[model samples]
Target: MIRYIKNIFLGIYCLLQGMYISMLNMIRPKVTEKYPENRGRKEMMERFRGLLTMPHNEQNEHKCTACGICMINCPNGTIQVISRKEPDEATGKEKRVLDRHLYDLGSCTFCALCTIACPQDAIAWSPVFEHTVFTRNKLVKQLNREGSKLEVKTGKS
Candidate 1:
């Protein structure tokens, strides 16, 4: 009988403790963000990895040599480098030229291994994270722009 009375008192104490915690939290200022309303004002952190992007210069030139280093390093087959042998203008010899650079964003884990392994520093992360899509086909992106050419750097005199 005494043990039963102790258990009842203990139960009441636990209930009151839980209620006190709940009351304290309810009185505190709300930290939840109003997402839709604050869409423009929403600021992502500096190191936030959002999307893989290949930066092109004003001349529509990119640094990707189609070396396949990025494609090889990707844990998931996210990156595809398609190249074709074209006659070099300067050398008059056949050279590998990048035809297409396909990036499957749906399969990517954002591990950044491809970016790190790139010898030409071809790929980087973009801050734009709004990637909500209904179809999987929309997720596959071509990193290289149409009519974009590989940038060649010459030794400065």
Candidate 2:
């Protein structure tokens, strides 16, 4: 009979303790995100590897030399470079022309492997992290700008 009374007191003590904690939590300040409030520059860091961008000149022509090294180094085959082989009459050899430079941002790991592998130092990270698109086709970016052949020098002169 005495042991039963002790257990009953212990259960009441535990119940009172839980109620006290719950009452304290109800009075205390609520910690929750306020989406309507502007956080200004104190925003959360966006986690993404991001896609590569070709460095352009004043006229927006890419610095790429149409080298196949970037294409070979890409682990996911995200980059597809199409070069036009133009035959030079004087040199008796075919010279490469930058026809198309396609980049699939979705498949890219952004390991910067392609950037490092490039001898021409063409590709770079452009600070453009927000690349949200409804369709997968929109994610594929073309490096070439129409009608401009302006050159971009990467390394020191």
Predicted model with the maximum lDDT? 1
TM-scores for candidates 1 onward, in order: 0.77, 0.62
Off by over 4 Å in 1: 1-32, 154-157
> Could you tell me which residue pairs clash in candidate 2?
none
Displacement of the residue 72 alpha carbon in candidate 1, Å: 0.5
Q: Model 1 residue 35 lDDT? A: 88
lDDT for every model? 0.92, 0.78
Please provide, for model 2 over 33-93, each residue's C-alpha lDDT reduced to its tens digit, 9 standing for 90 to 100: 5754744433443533455877777776766778789999999999999888877666889
Give per-residue CA lDDT, model 1, range 35-64, as digits (tens).
889897988777778999999999999998
| Worst ten in a row by lDDT for model 1 | 148-157
Question: What are the candidates' C-alpha RMSDs?
Answer: 4.2, 6.3
